[model samples]
Target: MRVLIVEDDAALAERLAALLGEAGLVAETVGDGREAAYLGCTEDYDAAVLDLGLPQLDGISVLRHWREAGRVFPVLILTGRGRWSDKLAGFGAGADDYLTKPFQHEEVVLRIKALLRRAGGHADPVLQAGDLSYDTFAGRFSLHGEPLALTAQEHRILAYLMHRKGAVVSRAEIGEHVYARDLEPDSNTVDVLVGRIRRKLPPGLLVTERGLGFRLVSEPEFRD
Candidate 1:
């Protein structure tokens, strides 16, 4: 999972990034809210940790802007304010979860995971498609009770595909989801990754849509 941390405090941001990275999340930190808003709106992040007090633009404004723009990624508000009104305002501004300062690292991680779970439309961290399962938190994949070894990129690609399941995801969409903005865009990257995943997956699991894209079809389709 990729997370963007919008925080002005350099030390705190670094600490949060390190902790999130240790938890197997690709974390990027930005000190100002303008850049945060831009990235949060344009990029495909699994979640965001936003601070209310920010430079250029306040975090609440950023959150509102993203919400207004129809950005649906889950957000966790982190700030020094811990009052009832503040909490209410944060939720009113479209934050999925809230965390106050001086919090334990474990608590932060847990809250982020909870937010991700909710965003994924599943209460559990593991995403399932028939006999195949992928653990989002653990970054692992299994097929029919057997552990499947995968590279980090492969794991991310498969996880993204499995999350969408029956939906056909285009290569462009997959590229935007898996790679950050800095990476070079190649039209065939998603297809290549899908090919690799197909070789690893059990037979008849992944389906290609010719010129369209690919979909995870775990169960056999009924036809006349």
Candidate 2:
């Protein structure tokens, strides 16, 4: 999954980015709210961690702008504002969840995971599609009840697909969520990775729609 971290604290942002990355998410950190607003509108983030105190613009305004632009990614307010009113404002401004400062990094990861699961219409930490299952909390995948080993990139691709299972995901969309902003992947990168994943998956599970894109179907009959 992909997440945006909007925090003015450089050190804290870096730490959160590292922790989220370790949790199998492609995390991008932006210190300014204006930049955050722009990226949130333009990028395909699964979720975001936003701080109320941001440079150039406040977090509330940025979030409001994103919502106005119809960007529906789940956002968790991570600020030092612990008051109930502050939290109400955050929620009023379109935050999906709230976390105060001096929070545990692990909790942040868990909250992000929960937001992702909820956004994906999944209540449980373990997401299942046929014999393939992904434990979002454990950051592990299982096939036919056995552990599935995948490289970091492969894991990200599969996780993103699993979250949006049954929908055709374009390669460009995959690239945006799978890689960091600075790293521009080659045009064939997603095709190569998907091919690798297809080899590991059961036949007819991951289907290609030629000019369209790829979809992970729970049943073989759903394939195009």
Candidate 3:
């Protein structure tokens, strides 16, 4: 899962970014609303944490522009504006959820998870791919009832794939979601990371699609 945080407050932005990162999601931050709007339109973010008050452009405008551009990623408005009108404006501008300031960091993470689940058409917090189980809320993976430990990069790649399980995902798509804006992955970076994940998973669980890309299957016929 990839998230974009658009907040002007440095401390708040850093804190939110760190919290989201700990939740096994790739998070990137931009302090300006113009930049946020551009990134939101350009990047393949699963969700966004947007602040209403912003520099260069306002959050409402940024969100409206995104919607006009047909960017349908879930957006949660995290702002100091507690007025019902502000929330209405956010919703009218195509926000999926709203949260006020002086909020709990855990709640932000939870809301983002719920948004992701709903966006992916998953009502449950846990995602199943064959014998592998991924707890979206806990940011943990278990295979056949055993815990599966993975590096951060591996986790991002697998998480994105699990969210869109059974569908072929290309290397370009993986790079967009797994890596942040500043970290442009090399040609073989995704291949290497997916290789590591394959080592950790059962045989045929993650399969390459030849000229296509990769797919995560919920039912894999493993053979020796």
Candidate 4:
């Protein structure tokens, strides 16, 4: 999964990024809330870890702005505040989950996974696309009961596609979800990844539209 960390403390931000990366997630860190707000509104991140005290703009204000603008990605507030009113205010400001400072790294990762599970509409923790099954929290995939190993990027792409199954997702849409604010690589990156995914899939599942984009063909019959 892809995550954005909005924190001002350089050391803490780097630590969080490294921990998240070790847990098989693509993570990006920004130091200020203005940049956080802009990236949060434009990019397609699965979840965000935000600190309440941020420069340029407070994290609560950033959350309010994104909520007002109808941005729906799950957000987890990580701050030093530990009072009841602060927790209430964080939730009131649209945070899906809250974590206080001096927390266990494992707990933070677990909380983020829980928030993502709730947000993705897969309340059971397992995402299913016909006979294929993927455990969102565990980051494991299986086809017809056999385990399938996938690269981190492949897992992210497949999870995003499966979350929006039946929709015709354009290459640009996939790119935005995979790489947030990072400059676009060549145009064929999406195609190359899709090709790799197709080779791993059983017989006929993923479908490509002639001049459009790609879709996961869930029906029994396949389409070109």
Query: Model 4 Cα displacement at 135 (Å)?
Result: 1.2
> Per-residue error at 71 for model 3, in Å?
0.5
lDDT (tens digit, per residue) of candidate 4 on 38-125:
9888877888999999999999999998899898889999999999899999999999999998898677777887787777566777
Writing each residue's lDDT as its tens digit, candidate 3 over 1-224 gives 78999999989889989999899888888899899989888888889999999999999999999999999999999999999999999999999999998899889999998899889888789999989999989989999999999988889899889888989999988878778867868758889999999999988999998889999998874544
Ten residues in sequence with the least summed lDDT for candidate 4: 178-187
TM-score between model 4 and native: 0.89
| lDDT (tens digit, per residue) of candidate 2 on 36-124 | 99999988888999999998999999999999999999999999889999999999989999999889988999999999988988888
Candidate 2 vs. true structure, TM-score: 0.95
lDDT of 4 at 111: 82
The parts of candidate 4 lying over 4 Å away from their true place are: 217-220
Q: Over the full model, what C-alpha lDDT does candidate 2 score relative to the true structure?
A: 0.90
Error of 4 at 88 (Å): 1.3
Model 2, runs deviating above 4 Å: 221-224
Task: Single out the weakest 10-residue window by summed lDDT for candidate 3.
Answer: 215-224
lDDT of 1 by residue, 61-107 (tens): 99999999899899999999999999999899899999888788667
Scored against the true structure, residue 151 in model 2 reaches a CA lDDT of 94
**Clash pairs (backbone) in predicted model 1:** none
Number of clashes recorded per candidate: 0, 0, 1, 0
